[model samples]
Target: MSVPVPYHATAQRPEWSSLPARLRAEVSTRMGAPVIQARTAGAGFTRGFAALLRTADGQSAFVKAAPHAEQPHLVDWYAREAAILTRLPAGLPAPRPRWTLWEAGWYVLCLDPVDGHTPRLPWDQAELTATLTAFADVAEALAEPPVELTALGLPRLADLARDDLLWWGEVAAGREQVPPLPAPARGRLADLVTLESRLPRYAAAATGLTHGDLRVDNVLVDTAGSVWFCDWPWLCHGPAWFDLVTLLITGYATGLDVDSLFAAQPAAASAPDDALDVTLAALAGYHLTAATSAPPTASTNLPAHQRWTGEQAIRWLSHRRGWL
Candidate 1:
């Protein structure tokens, strides 16, 4: 059989923003403006599409889309994101949301874009550290009990978990013509999967809110030094360490040893091994999904993301293998 496509194989392109005209019309009707076109803008992952809209007046607004597959009925992801933004403390860095809607099995959210640069590999540790703490503050304040993601008409963490195991996990395990990972790494992953199987028992203890996906790529820092997190499709309340650990591992894989950087945040650094396991599993699940969806060939743009992902997979395996 041919090699499987990697998760989010399709790059965010110009047309990913092609919402049904009716949706566009609805946008125009709701916003009371004639939208000329919703131009594809910026890179996004794990959702329908994202773009920027140019109104008849030449004003621009960033747009993110969630198709039916992402949300079955209510558009909870979109609603939760809006709620998070609205609840955000004044003066914190994030995009200014203009509107959000659930229409025709699609959830659309529009916000004002902040001009900024996407940080490359080896992220600036000092900048990232401060930004992370700030983000954590916001996330912590926004933390709440788990909401039925599907009640808002979107897939929940449970849905993504099932899809990951059945689809992405199987695909990763089935790669035939791929370069072999080091034996140590291979042995490591086997152990991780075994350990992860016992997570349900510990999961009940990790109650609260989390950003779900808090990696660096999901963040955008503008030229004026403002940071914006674009995608909110996977927002949820769970383990407190979930967001921090995700950021740390992503930071580590990208050559920034976040643990060293955050050596000052002793409280955060003191997270136990068991919590790390859960965080690693969540991160691993994302990597496996990406590996399943991605083609064998690598891309320059996502090197950090891919490298970090690969490294995290090994870390998970090692922990599972009792190496940790």
Candidate 2:
């Protein structure tokens, strides 16, 4: 089996000293004291500058900054994340946004500090259970989303899937080349296309709010064994089970009993019997198609990650379908 990809160490962040002097000054001023120490974080996929900043008086905060002039898109994502975090219900195990600043052509967001580490690989049942427990509460709270949040005019997942998630259809239409696959899966391309094409309709029937992006790198396990989620820009209206499947990809890679895990989660309670299979097929097509493109200059490991994720999705689907 391929090793679990190192999700945490893929991000490339700049040192505190390397930030523009004016930006550092503004951040320190906002912190209420002169900055004393900074520790760069290794998690996340963006090239944004994220670090734990300490003040001379012992106060600390996690700060993320992106060069707006250089990468306007990343900066926009961070700004949207700040907006989403502030609107979420209190006490959701997500870091609360403290403030935001713009200086020296950079956009910065500061959040409440969470004393935790990214969940390690070769997944442990205990950690996996903790993560799921945390998400169960999140699912319950978001099951009927608040009117205020819905008012944000968040794009529906079903809508986004129409544009970004229908890679198998593209392949079948000859718009994109078919990616290499195992013999079993290769022979069943038509079935794969059918399964993947159902996601938009399946997701359209749900009303719950989903994290939209829940992977190992987006979660943290605290010292007390409580799990906390991070990153909020991708929040959308979709089936809760969707995030469950995305998060469990790491569990599957570690050889965990993911089928049982999926069966037990409250998030999956409303899922249709074939939801998991449809999701796996859709993901397999998306990742496999994405893996063939040139790696982004920002994250070199992304293609590798896509390839492995696609492979895992296919393997997981094949096992459940008895395609062997």
Name the 10 consecutive residues with the lowest summed lDDT in model 2.
Answer: 294-303
Give lDDT tens digits, candidate 1, residues 242-301: 566666664555555454444444324434456556446545655644553454222333
| Location of the lowest summed lDDT over 10 successive residues in candidate 1 | 1-10
| CA lDDT for candidate 1 | 0.54
- Candidate 2 per-residue lDDT over residues 125-217, each given as its tens digit: 788889999999998898899887888888898997888988988999899999989766878889999998899998999988999989888
What stretches of model 1 exceed 4 Å from their correct place?
Answer: 1-10, 14-39, 56-58, 66-96, 101-107, 143-180, 197-203, 262-270, 293-308, 315-324
Best by lDDT: 2
lDDT of 1 at 211: 63
Report how far off residue 234 is in candidate 2 (Å).
Answer: 0.5
Q: What ranges in model 2 sit over 4 Å off?
A: 2-5, 294-297
